[model samples]
Target: MPRAVRSPADFWSGALFAGFGIAFAVAALAYEPGRATRMGPGFFPFALAVVLSLIGLATLVRSWLRAGPPPLGLTSRPMVLVLGAVVAFGAMLHALGLAAALCFVVLVSASASSRFRWPRALLLAGAVSGLSVLVFATALQLPIPVLGRWLGG
Candidate 1:
């Protein structure tokens, strides 16, 4: 008889990784990969897909070799808060602009952690927002405004 999977976490993660890798690899075929000397837009994605597939294969093999506890169930609190943070960022980006959106996302997501504190959350939000503005706005010169129409930019 065939051996069953001993680790649910490994088996599920491997399947998910393999699925994503195959999907990305197939999608990459539509674009030109170019040569190794001068890679095209598709080359990096294709290479990454191959690496992901290999990791998945290793994990799948490990699932059969070693016994492990069953995967823990997902919690709604963290999931909801994190997803909310992403949505908040998207919703606020155009209206409040990048800095505010980044700060909002950080604060909301930080609330999901058990060790969350207001002072720490605010500090982290400020640091990340400032760094993001420095990198994407000042340094990279992305066209996104620091403040939007809602904030009288």
Candidate 2:
């Protein structure tokens, strides 16, 4: 009898995780991974890769052991919109500044949802922008401007 996948989604997800983990692990090997006490540049990446690979292996095993929901069909709309939002964020960061770029990103990304609402999206954008400014600008002291040249900052 031919073997069949119990959970297609889990199987694919596991494959993706394992692939990325392996790739990153290999790349991490380029840098010296020091001991736990004195971790080198590659230590963190290597550690994360190991964990990810283990999780992927476990998920792959589980996929064969238990049934799960049907695999979801691909949808291009959300993907395109989300990718566009990222590109927009990058482009607008310097021109529009961090806060405005973040807000635009939020609005554009939120629009990808079927149940998107302008009001809710706006609120979320404000909150995210404010928190990002506080964390990245104030706390971390990054040089990202609050308002860019276009915004008269």
Candidate 3:
């Protein structure tokens, strides 16, 4: 294996993913078992951990085969900006409602394009938010928050 100081970023990322995957898998094992007859609280988390571990291992293997793993492949500015938006979006939900959360997710996710416009964005965000509120939270009964209880509207 040629280790002539190739891209260090790949090695690090692979290591990090590996660590996270292993940690999640280990955590799954520690979850409490079913109480009486049905699956317990640990069921979902445990299943998710297994999938994560498999993906992490595959990533590590591929990176090893590829020449110096590409860096985290994220730009510094976009990363920071997106992270800030995510935090702000979550914070807004507490003050707003399910409508706000749906809007935030849609708007923030759509913002990756340079051609995004406020008017179009708002229209699309509002439509999607309204549909989500009506369908999943109401028709499907997904137990989502509404603007009424908090906003008294």
Candidate 4:
């Protein structure tokens, strides 16, 4: 008889990482990667892909050697909420601008957790929005408006 799967989590995680790593590596090849001392646009991504692939391979091998609990069933609520938050952020970004988009994303995503609380979610949203503004607007001076034209910018 065939051997039973030992560690489903490790196996699945490894497969996912390896798949992403390979995809990234292939995509990075389209750009020119310079030598390590003189990095090019593709250099960092290619290097990271190599490291990720190695880690995934190690994880896959380990799954066969170790015993672990069976993989948990997928839940739709958290997945839907988190994905919806990302889509909402993208859709609202141009109209509402970065700060509002960040707040929406944070609050919506926070609700995905079973332990979500209004106070905590609001606090987290405020912190993330402030930090994003500080980084992207004040520090980086990105051209993105703090408030969009729709908000009387």
Candidate topping TM-score: 1
Residue 4, model 4: lDDT of: 62
lDDT of model number 1: 0.90
Each model's C-alpha lDDT?
Answer: 0.90, 0.90, 0.71, 0.88
Model 2, global lDDT = 0.90
Instruction: Compose the digit string of candidate 4's lDDT tens values, residues 15-109.
Output: 88888899999999988898778989999999899889888888788788898876796899999999999999989888988899999999999
Candidate 4 residue pairs that clash: none
lDDT of 1 by residue, 65-127 (tens): 988777797899999999999998888888899989999999999999999999999999999
Q: Provide the lowest-lDDT 10-residue window in model 2.
A: 1-10
Off by over 4 Å in 3: 1-4, 14-69, 81-86, 148-150
For model 1, name the residue pairs that clash: none
Predicted candidate 2 versus true structure: per-residue lDDT over 20-116, tens digit per residue = 9999999999999888899999999999998999888888888888998756867889998999999999998888899999999999999999999
Q: For all the candidates, what are their Cα RMSDs to the real structure?
A: 6.0, 6.1, 6.9, 6.1
Candidate 3 per-residue C-alpha lDDT over 1-153 given as tens digits, one digit per residue, 9 for 90 to 100: 235435557566656777787787787778775755788877777777777767766656665666664466667666655676678767766567788777886787667667778889889999998998889888999865666345753
lDDT of 4: 0.88
Candidate 2 Cα outliers beyond 4 Å, as residue runs: 1-3, 35-39, 71-74, 93-153
Candidate 4 regions exceeding 4 Å error are 1-71
